[model samples]
Target: MKHEKRWAIVSLASIPLVMTLGNSMLIPVLPTIEKKLNISSFQVSMIITLYSIVAIILIPIAGYLSDRIGRKKVIIPSLLIAGMGGIVSGWAAWKMDNPYILILIGRVLQGVGAAGAAPVVMPLVGDMFKSEKEVSKELGVIETSNTFGKVLSPILGSLLAGLVWFLPFFAIPIFCAISILLMLFLVKSPKMKKPVPFKKFFKTIKKIFKKNAKWLIAIFIIGCILMFVLFGVLFYLSTMLEDEHKIEGVKKGLILAIPLASLCIASFVTGKKIEENKVLMKWLTFIGILLSAGSVFAISFTENIYFLISIFFICGMGIGVALPCLDALITEGIEKEERGTITSIYSSMRFIGVASGPPLFVLLMKASHQVMYYTVTGICILAAIIALVGIKPKEIK
Candidate 1:
């Protein structure tokens, strides 16, 4: 029980790793999915959107259920559902031969499972750690876990898809299984006496709406805008490499990884510093947004892969520095009980941004790649402005 805190952090952190891996692994293998399914590019885009749509719907419900039941109970089953979805998806990909439908099915189920676990995990972390400092550090670790998954996912997906079309689907179940094991062994939640009444729950929401609506709105919107900018740029970068530069296989993986690598390093460092100063956190985030915008803006001017990859690393680093702090600031401000609900709302906004980014950016690129990149650059700059001006930490009740 002494190292309960460390164990809890590890367990809570693993949940995001599983979730991120499942969501990102498809990026490298999107072309394979299109080839196998013989679907239009527009339809393939839905494979990603459908999952986000499901998470958007289910996240609030999951948060409410976790509050009523228990965090661990909800999380464990959610992992199982996600793992099972992976299995079904793999099987569907192999047996049905229509990879698109099967992938969508799997993504839908994964989304359902995602709703239950992803939003609740951070609140569980909040439950385990009392110190605002510890919460900030732990949230950094959790965000790192998410990026770590991104760092590994493309390589894993590329290797797996290289082996077989269905193999990438299997990676999800495996990650979920590992997450389930960690949650079972490591995460220990305090008991709750009774579920909050629906009437009271709504009243609390209304109260929060009236009081902290600005912060709540800002954080969620910021979360959404941040993800939109991050992923939209990623989508554009990947396509630029694949279609224009003609990079493929492991080389493509490494070039793509430059950004994620930068992000990983920034996340770890920012995590270390966040608790010491709120102003530092605010400035770090603001600077990160500036770096992100600058890097993308630079990438727009370059047709050279070398120039593009270098600027992308800077962009990635900025995003990396910004994300953990953003997560910490948002969840750290809320009470433990309300963390799940608020975090869910924040995550839903993030999913909305992420869901919109790929297709919308893809459309913009159809017109002009420069326009697409500039649009995302503007969004990141706006997000930076919002974080700098909108967020002012409050005393915890």
Candidate 2:
């Protein structure tokens, strides 16, 4: 890559890093918030869910706008809105006697901003690169940045919440500001063709879907399943560490980071290795999800914390390898004019997974630990089947 493109990647990478931190950092803090506000587990889980739910509704619209306008035009303003949402949450947490509802509203605003920011990165990366290999490699970098944010979130979140329970909320704006500055100074938006009329755009999108519906829908479903399992497991682990093991604060956070670190490393490595190979992308995705399913199934038989942590690390690696493959498949397969919309729809599906995970996990855990593990394992198996059966590499382009 050229130096300019490298810098642009850096700027583009920051969006997912900041966006992930804004959301995932709050996972470790949920227990703290639960205690502080005297709320139930379900209510605290809503903090994550509400942000994702709002994002799900608005992401397609953002994608469409980015396609018609420009990626940077959509992203910078979204960052501002996300930062403002952080301020609202932080102020309510710091000042209000009853901050729960206000905090949720703030999350809603952040979701609206997120709809435009991170999901746009994949398509923007596609826009920036002409080579299929370059697109695959950079998408890996973007995915790695996302997972790195996950790895860092628990530790950073714990450290911040240790200082003040609401400190993490305040940190969102600072993160967003850094991303915005980087984007403004470093990233150049690719020149786009004349904007198509809405009717023509719609027809084009429908045609693309009709031609590629099988693998496209399969990838969308797989993305949703992976996120659903990832967030659900994180929620389960966070609560388990605190409530059952008597672990809290940074120690708990470090423990939480172990699995995510595995994920981060695997994503970086996978991204580097799988350059433009659609067949490899399909197999890696299938094998990765199978690995996750096996690990999750093993969890049903063990309660030892070490064993559990080790299993999660394996599961993370499984998820790590698969994610960039999914990213590359979608980004590489789509035409530039429609890439934003297609990838955004894929993103919205992932957010559905994010939105559903914790609350759904809470209900499953209530039934039994075996039930929870078994259920996720079953879902993972289904996703693997979808990858193997639906994604025909020869058909992609």
Candidate 3:
């Protein structure tokens, strides 16, 4: 039974790797898609934004359904839909040669499927692990898989794009397929000794929120701001590489992969430390925002590509250190029964930042490089203020 439970955690952890790969894997391929389709910068940016839009719309619904039906039931279908979407996008990229519409449609599908997989995985982890310590440890493993996918996807996606621009789209389906199999074979839903009544369940949810609404909202906003700052920088850097530096395809992939590598390393280290101390987590998050804000500032000061890349890497490390702690904080704050709904809300706020980041950053870039830094910097300051004011350490557990 113990082995079964551990295997279940490992299996569920794979869901994020499969779903997020479709999102991050496409980053390196973005420049290729632009060339293939001859789309404008705004249109190229739309592919990413559209994916987030779909997720933002669907995540709460998926989370609600997971609560109603069961996590496994919703998750399996979500993977299948996302995989089909990937295959369709690849075919469209190949046949129509109009990368824009095909990729957009594919991304929408990926988002819908991805919506169910990512938001639910955390709640599932909550349901499985009984102890705070165990939950923290598993959250670390889960967070690692999530960041690892981000790290590896760009490298692999870039390599695939080298062979064929459309390959990354098709490649995601294979991962989804594997995840589906593992989920079905190895993952099992825990038997609930007693289920909550609908009225009581709603009352319980309200009570939890009533107790911690302020902190919950603060953490959600902080996560959103962090995502906003992180992705905004990434979008700006990707464009700078292709437009200013004249880097494309595999070279673009290599440059982008540098910061993601930092993100992967930092996520693993921070997850452990955060489990031990919320005060430390709070300080680390503040520092992460500082590092990220500094990176955006650094980009404005330098025309040197190496320095620009270094700043982006520093920002990614800040995000990496901050993300798991955010997850751990939310998990620690909520009761087990409410985990699905609360995590869903948390995921939605993060997607809101993601969905908005690119277009907002791109728009700011038109004004000046300094504008981009200031915008992200302002967001970080807001997040920092919330952390300082709203998150009381004693209340986390």
Candidate 4:
């Protein structure tokens, strides 16, 4: 990659970092919000759920729009809308005696913004780069940047929420604004010479899926399952520490960052190595899911924090390795014109996982610990089976 291109990747990469910050940063503070707002635990989970629910519905539409118009044009305005949502939620939290419903509304707008923005980055990265090797390397960096956000979100959310229960909500616009400025001035998206027409767009998509549906559908399911497991574990761990152990604030955040750090390292390493080697990517996906399943299954054997942390870290590492391969397979497999739409569908599935994780975990926690871990492990087993059988390198690459 050229120096200019590297800078553009950095600018584009910042979008996910910012978007992750806005959403994941609030996890630690959810208990605080529950107490302050006098809402139920499920309601606190709804704060996270509604955002992804909105995004899940609109992401395909945004993907279609980006394909129709252009990436930057869609992304810039989406950032502004997301920022505006932050402002609304922040104002509601800061000023109103009862801010729960209004805050959910703000999150809905943020979800709309997220629909148009972050998912578009995958296709945009594919658009800007020409070489498969470069795209793979850069996609790894993008994934790392995202996991890094997970690493930062808890720490930052804890710090801010310590000052005020609602401080993280206020911080969203500031992060989004910075992302906006970098995107506006620093990044240069490829010009679309001829946009796809509405009538032919669905036709093209249908054809792509018809030809590649086997691997594509497998990749989508794997993506969704990994995210669902990751978020579910994180939610379970968060509530366990804060409510059960009475762990609070930055200490809790730092503890949360451990598994995320393992995940980040795995993604960064695998992203560099998996370029164009469809066979290696296939095996990695299979092996990564196996690791995740085994780790979660190990969780059923112990309640010790040290042991649990080690197991979860391994699980995170497996997921981290698996995701970039999925990204590469899908991104490299699809044409540039169709990349945005297909990748957006992939992103939407991932969001559905995120949307479903917390609430589902909350309910699952009511059961035995064995049940929770085993349920997740079962999902991982399904993902692994899909990866092994469904992903044919000859077909995808």
TM-score of every candidate relative to the true structure: 0.96, 0.99, 0.95, 0.98
Q: List the residue pairs that clash in candidate 3.
A: none
Residue 61 in candidate 1, Cα distance off native in Å: 1.0
Candidate 3, backbone clash total: 0
lDDT against the true structure, per candidate, is 0.80, 0.96, 0.82, 0.90
**Candidate 3 TM-score, C-alpha based:** 0.95
Each candidate: RMSD:
1.6, 0.7, 1.8, 1.0
**Candidate 2 segments whose C-alpha is farther than 4 A from its true place:** none
Residue 248 of model 3: what lDDT? 75
Q: Write the per-residue lDDT of candidate 3 for residues 177-260, one digit (tens) a residue.
A: 898998999998765435577798789888888888888898899888877776666777777888899887777877887898
As a whole number from 0 to 100, the lDDT of residue 371 in candidate 3 is 79
- Comparing candidate 1 with candidate 3, which one achieves the higher lDDT? 3
Per residue, candidate 4 scores C-alpha lDDT tens digits across 1-397 of 4888888888988999988988999888888899999999899999989999999999988888888789998999999999988889889999999999999999999999999999999999999888999889899999998889998989999999999878898899998898889988888889885976777888989999999999999999999999998888888888888877788999999888889899889999999998889899999999999999999899888767788788889989999999999999999999999888899999999999999999998888788777788898899999999999899999975
Q: Cα deviation in Å at residue 312, candidate 1?
A: 1.0
Considering lDDT, where higher is better, how would the candidates rank from best to worst? 2, 4, 3, 1
lDDT of 2: 0.96
* lDDT for residue 397 in candidate 1, whole number 0-100: 30
Model 1 residue runs over 4 Å out of place are 394-397
Q: Higher-TM-score candidate among 1 and 3?
A: 1
Per-residue C-alpha lDDT of model 2 across residues 79-124, encoded as one tens digit per residue:
9999999999999999999999999999999999999999999999
